[model samples]
Target: MTQKQDGDPKSLSAEEAKAEFLALQERLRAADIAYHQEDAPVISDAEYDADKRRYAALVAAFPELEKDATQLNSVGAPAASGFGKVSHAVPMLSLGNAFEDEDVADFARSIRKYLGLSVQDPLAFTAEPKIDGLSLSLRYEDGVLVQAATRGDGSVGENVTENARTIADIPEQIAGAPRILEVRGEVYMSHDAFAALNQRQQERGGKVFANPRNAAAGSLRQLDAEITRSRPLQFFAYSWGELSEPLADAQIEAINRLRSLGFSTNPLTRLCSSLEEMIDHYRSIEAQRATLGYDIDGVVYKVNDLSLQGRLGFRSTTPRWAIAHKFPAELAWTRLEAIDIQVGRTGALSPVARLAPVTVGGVVVSNATLHNEDYIAGRDSKGAEIRGGKDIRVGDWVQIYRAGDVIPKVADVDLSKRPESAEPYSFPHVCPECQSPAIREEGDAVRRCSGGLICPAQAIEKLKHFVSRGAFDIEGLGNKQVEQFYADEWIREPGDIFTLRERFGSGLQQLKNREGWGEKSAANLFDAIDEKRTVPFAKFIFALGIRHVGEVAGKDLALHYGEWSALTSALDAARAAALAHRAADEAEDAERIAAEAEGRRARISETRAAAIKACGVPNEAQAAWDDLVGTDGVGPILALSLSDALANPEERAAIDRLADHLNIVPPDAPAAESPVSGKTVVFTGTLEQMTRAEAKARAEALGAKVSGSVSKKTDILVAGPGAGSKATKAAELGIKVLDEAGWLELIG
Candidate 1:
């Protein structure tokens, strides 16, 4: 019988303790399932793991918990009979874990020692983040997702077909036929999405998820396919289960094949030529972990050579070919003395958690990001603080730690550690820079200064966003260049970009006479600028730099609005609509009681309607906007940003000036009767004829806008092999879905 720990009730019998342990196991397992399989976590990973470890300890202390029902050795129950069980075409396995650098080096030594290779012998590996999420086996016959199963019991698992289809990162079909492929990988959530989801959950009074891994698992396990569809779950393939015929000689080659097939493989994956290089890769990942926006426990080192992996294959549960070098979890307790608001590059007032220094993962932590006042204050009925700690009052002890070591956040406050003389913090009601009233836009979490077109911080960020890849994608103008220009007073706003030639003309001529900026390079730059001038409506929209707008959104906006002139006019109106929309939607009929109801409602409704309508492209002018949005893979946030950029009067004038400076001709329209002229095409499935990215670019060259998803009005769906639900949906909606050959024929 499992014995209870010191905190257990003294009256409890031995059998009762065993029963409680078993009950705890079941409860925790259910929570894990909710986390790993469902993409909705009921508890935090820390809480779940802690409970699991406690249960394990109890079992160890009292042998009663070791009975068949409570033991950890039970194979992951029986495979759910939803799909026929197929023996792993190639066995899906786990990796051995190492908590520190020494452990990682030890793993490397073992690999070398086991293979009887000398210290000088070449040993290569492909290192990727050991993502914390559910593991699955994806089976493909000739490059299509035929079946996918959970990594239940290392043997068989529930067949989650309908749910898996919702994941955007998973490929339904692969390019170039590879007889069979059984890929293994972790499904996870991006940090941005995870935070957004948690926020939504908290707003709705639902149990908040602790981390992305748990959220991903819980989302994936949702019995309702529609529920799964709503979650933001992404999958990254790290290895394969089986291959009837090997596609690559090395692990790197195999991964390249996967990337070519439209799967979003980790770009950071590297081929370490030696053990030292492998260690270098691990260190690099560790440094970058916090910035990656995904959680990784450690780096997974694999034997790159396929032949070597085969020779080193198979342990009962894990493979000898790969090992996991886990970085220690970054968690620490710090005394929170106060919270301060800092102005962001965008004029956003960000709440910073100030704390007494503490150490975690060898880094001293004094300040962590609270993201916004709303986050620190906690939403209440009247936008007041609900947690009694408004704006993180001074002298409160705060817990500080890095989530995945990428985001430093204040997890909690230790009221007991707070000083008796401490006072509640008062949040600033005015902008720290321009003294403008800082207004929290309806439905927005961050408060911002309304000094648009004037705020230096906002201007700089806008300009930066303008030249960003997601925006105008201006070459030769990166962050450093933007900052230099801003400091030198060469540019103030996004519109100032067009004035670059004027400011640089004399200087550029001198530079041309100097070493590097010769005629060729200068000419190349001018040519690049000219090329950008006749920008696609979509790209122009993305360059606008709007809050809550991103590249994809920009395309949607451009596709919706069509012309620069129309988009600007619409966005001007949309800005008004946005305020009204939020005021109306923030809560029930409370819109009536909103202090600034009339002003807010009128402004927001106008802005939002324009923005939404801009996104939808409801008419011919809109269709012109939609044409830009239709550019394959454009998203909503980008679309909004693009709309805002073009809408700005200063930016428009700058474009006009740039247009005059270059005397550049607009892009020539496609020839009449051309197959792709002015058409909207969305590509899906496995594209064997060409790389998916290449195909989209080619389509753009032919004047056909490529869209990401199938819509009722889509002119065509470029259906490659393994065309699944999208193709079927297209057929149902009467949209044409073309295979690779069909597409080639059309373009020809």
Candidate 2:
């Protein structure tokens, strides 16, 4: 019995099987603890599922022995808490999963029958990826994320406060002032990061993660935050459990609200007005699963209308309003033309596929991601020797398919499809954008340019990024416009944008004299530029387009660095220090130059540290800087962007010119509004002051723009529960993420 309990296959007697059943319960419980509370898991889903199924069968056969089988009735353990715990306004529940298309169709049929509607009836369903990850219940008070919890059982679970904070995707607060709200969703690991992490673990002689789902579960469960911090995690919100006020009249609106609040809701999500569209979406997603960068076993279909969903009610673990449409796990073949490396704002080198133009679904896809180097050189299923053109080279036909939309990756290469003359791809030794030498950072597979802001490609991309909706938001200047300007010698640097009015004034005047460009239209365009001139410090920082800087980061930078003049001085000093540290390393004075190097690195990477250092004297601190740094959530990335921008002479001049007219003034410090002021307000997340619908209505009533995401035109991002990506991007762009309290303080 003891041997059976310990997973010894040899001990397969009936009595031993009974004992093993009890042990299985304990194992499952422990696994659940690791998964739900800590945001990590110890075993693969297949292994866990096998054990669970085996235990279930044993308990069913031996009801007498089932008395000790705690799996059936035991409530889950509570998570270790770092935040104040609060009961959810509504209980967040899990969905029943399906493993086949037929099962999904059956579910759809059942839903129709339950509602007494014929299959031909105009029933609408929204199909989205069923994300496999940890579930979280976010609670908002006055539009702030006051508490977040793990979904333990159907009813209760452990508190994972500190663990949640490590997830940058989760927002700490939302905008708008609703009384209460609760949102629920899954948090998981990205495939690339998961593979990288597992590789590191294997190299270190540690256990390897079987998949991204397991990796996510494992990362979240670590008792030490430092461990969790090392893992790359992402989140996607699909539903809400409860709210103080009805968020939206429709389920689609609710999801939209969640997205606006800063959560990474699936952008592919669509609202279905008819069953055909719903089924089409399900089939379409099933077909395109291989292109999505995550693993998803199935698509979760839900009713589009909140009222209709409410009318349907729910079962024990699953909602009656929703069903999972499972896609078959299969791979498909496609040709890979060439591999191109793209450097992100964070300097992560991603391999992109230049494929033979193929139509998958409605879109023509000419590119696919190659993932990492190891994938390119790997073999296939048939054991027929997977070969690239030269060696995982261009002109190789590849196979790909998704278990789900969570991670889309290359599965195999067809040697026969390789072109006879295809050449082996040689990765550039230098940054493609800049002439600077590229170096792989410590323990990282991706090589990055050491050129910093000197690279033309990097600079152009940064400028475009800065002008993006979440950043400086120069309306007429979009990606194409910026690219054209950069290519045509219209703008050499970010600061050159400020001088555009002087350079293009004649162009504008001439245009007004032409057929299409009226004086009023040209004046409006100029006015738009003028509007962006006196931008806020955070926006200004984001507009500089530094590597890794986003809206949230931009805000953090602005608050820390304060005034432009002071920040520039600090960056110059920091740049000098970074140079010194590099020199010290080359000279082998690693220990002797430790302090000097330390000071330099801190300025480069440490946002708060550098700001504090920069703000050495009382007189050196500007009121805005002091207040900015003192703000609750400001941090490092923001500080760096601010410092860099301030250091640029061009930026300084741009600021001076803009300040001459469009001086950035803080929003009327949380004050009462005029009855009829045509004001603008942007919502950042879930609102606790009012329901999302109510908030939008109120904004419209007050003559404000109710937008989907943060843009230059957006007045606010009325955020509520589970705000994630939007918030981060907003910060990167220097847009504000106001809490309900702040919003109410201002509006009231």
Candidate 3:
């Protein structure tokens, strides 16, 4: 009869466990749908697994509380509606996870207890890399591949036979396979392939995939076979589903048989006779993961002996003979020294958790993303209460972890270690950099400064971005130089960069006489700036640092508008649209205010009239706004942000001044003679010989319009490794798909 602590599932009472159990079920179900159906993961794998583990722990602690439809018994969500339904011969069960070495030891001990084996008895286990990919089952009849299905909801799956047939690694005809065999494997994209596919996706104005696993899943489940053919998908056979005959006596032998039958198997698979050896092998695999060309989140250890495995048979959803040893989350506990708000180029006031120096996965981490105000207020992106509704405060002990080894995030807070003197952190209503009012729009997690380019922080950041490697990339004009110039008011904006030689070259306080600047170095800097004065349309668009406009988006905008004036006009129109929307909203508010008070009616009416006047847009302007919104990859959210930035008179004037200083070249139309020329082209996945920027530049030079996404409008899709949703969509649209070599040949 232990009483439950607020957030501790371990200390939960029976009643508390029941409530938490129901909540977890709903949360997990939503997560499953988001991951399996939409291919958009709302939470990290570590967070998802933690939730599942907590539910299991609660159920284990109170066995009677377990329900029939518990999340633990499920594999994945049901098959998406479009695909043909497939009934799995054997349920594709998920493995129980082991997050620690002790968990691995417990798994071995549990097996020993179930089998009633002596401690001294040798328990051989086969350890293999746990590929982060889509689980696929290939059914063969008389050594010929007959059907293939995805592991949807364990028992029922989506039939992807035609799509599976296109995968080169999946044999159409096995030479020595059993009469009826169901080879279970993972359909995955290599790291290089995934990169190339993303690159192609960006180039074509297609949806960029989140990770290799998502890419593989999205690719393999394509409705069109041709799309699957274009994707760089590979499979690794690890287990069997239903077999007419026993392939081998042991797991290692069975894997060898699969390899012999022309199936790709993980080369890191090893047999371990002891727990120590098994754990050691897992460590070895973990160490090689970065260099493995594919993504592996963890390692799987299964009993080698088929007899022993059968003896320790099935649990509700997992096999007792096997356990997935997950790589330990790169987490560290540290005191939150302070919470600082950093204004981005887009004017997003991002909260950063300044932590006491702590090591996470061997890297010294002193800062972690608070994400937004909601996160700081102990709420999720959806505004749902998190961490038992405990807001993070300065001087609190918090757990930080790196998600995918890229972004450091605050995982959990140790409430017991929170300082008594610490008060709840109050996020500022104004931008710290420029004292501008920071407003959080409805449904937006981030609170952004509305100052636009007028904010010193935003302006300086835009200047930094303008001079960045992917933009102007002027030599001798690095971040330090940009910062120094901005601080000294020598270069307050991007336009100033182009006029620096004229303004500062012969001045009393010349750049040559400044600290760290010799006459030759200053001359070289000026020369570099001069060289970049005549910038490409794409580069110029990107240098503007518009909100939500990344390199790909900039390229898309450039391709769509063609000329600087056209692009600027479209942006202005979009800005006018936004202004009109805001005016209408204000007028409505004024009407309400006038109704509330008679004295304020005249003032309110005057304001409303002004707002309505601002809202007025001509047919041409409306059409420009329509074009801006309709552009591929430039959705409403991005369009709104871009419009707002450009609508600000100060920002628009700054951009116009910058444009005047630079000779902005219009985008070249695709070459008429080239096969891919004039085609709306998309590049997905990784390129071997050149970077994505170089490929995009080359494609643009050849007169191809590089888009960020795929649509019916896309004429050609240049697919590389890890081509996911876009490639599939292209096939559905009957768009032409080409590999890197094909693209090169066509361009030549």
Best by lDDT: 3
Residues 1-748, model 2: lDDT tens digits: 1111123333343334543553455456555545554444443343344455566566666654443444543333343333334454455665554555555667677767665677668777777887777677777778777666766544654456677777888887888625777778888876678778978998999878656776786676666778887789878887776667887888788888788888889877877766567667877886777678776766788887777676566543456788766555444567776788875443445567776765432223455555444335442111122333224678788665434222234545677777888776666667776668877532233466767556766667667666654456665666777777787687766667766667777567653664545787766666767777677876765555554343444544455556665555555555533333333333333332454556643222343334344535343333433443333233222333344555567655655554555455332332335532355565655565455545555555454546666666444554567788877777777766677776666556
For model 3, residues 8-54, the per-residue Cα lDDT tens digits are 55554333455455445544654665676556565456756776877
Q: Model 1, 99-143: lDDT tens per residue? A: 567766787787776666778887888887778777877888877
Task: Show the lowest summed lDDT stretch of 10 residues, model 1.
Answer: 1-10
- After superposition of all CA atoms, the RMSD between model 2 and the true structure is 22.6
Score residue 517 of candidate 2 by CA lDDT: 56
Give per-residue lDDT, candidate 2, residue 482: 74
Worst 10 residues of 2 by lDDT: 1-10
Model 1: how far residue 437 lies from native, Å: 1.5
Q: Model 2: what TM-score?
A: 0.41
Q: lDDT winner between 1 and 2, please give it.
A: 1
Off by over 4 Å in 3: 1-328, 403-407, 506-509, 572-618, 672-748
Predicted structure 3, TM vs. truth: 0.49
Q: In candidate 3, how many Å is residue 113 off?
A: 42
C-alpha lDDT (0 to 100) for residue 114 of candidate 3 = 64
TM-scores for the candidates: 0.44, 0.41, 0.49
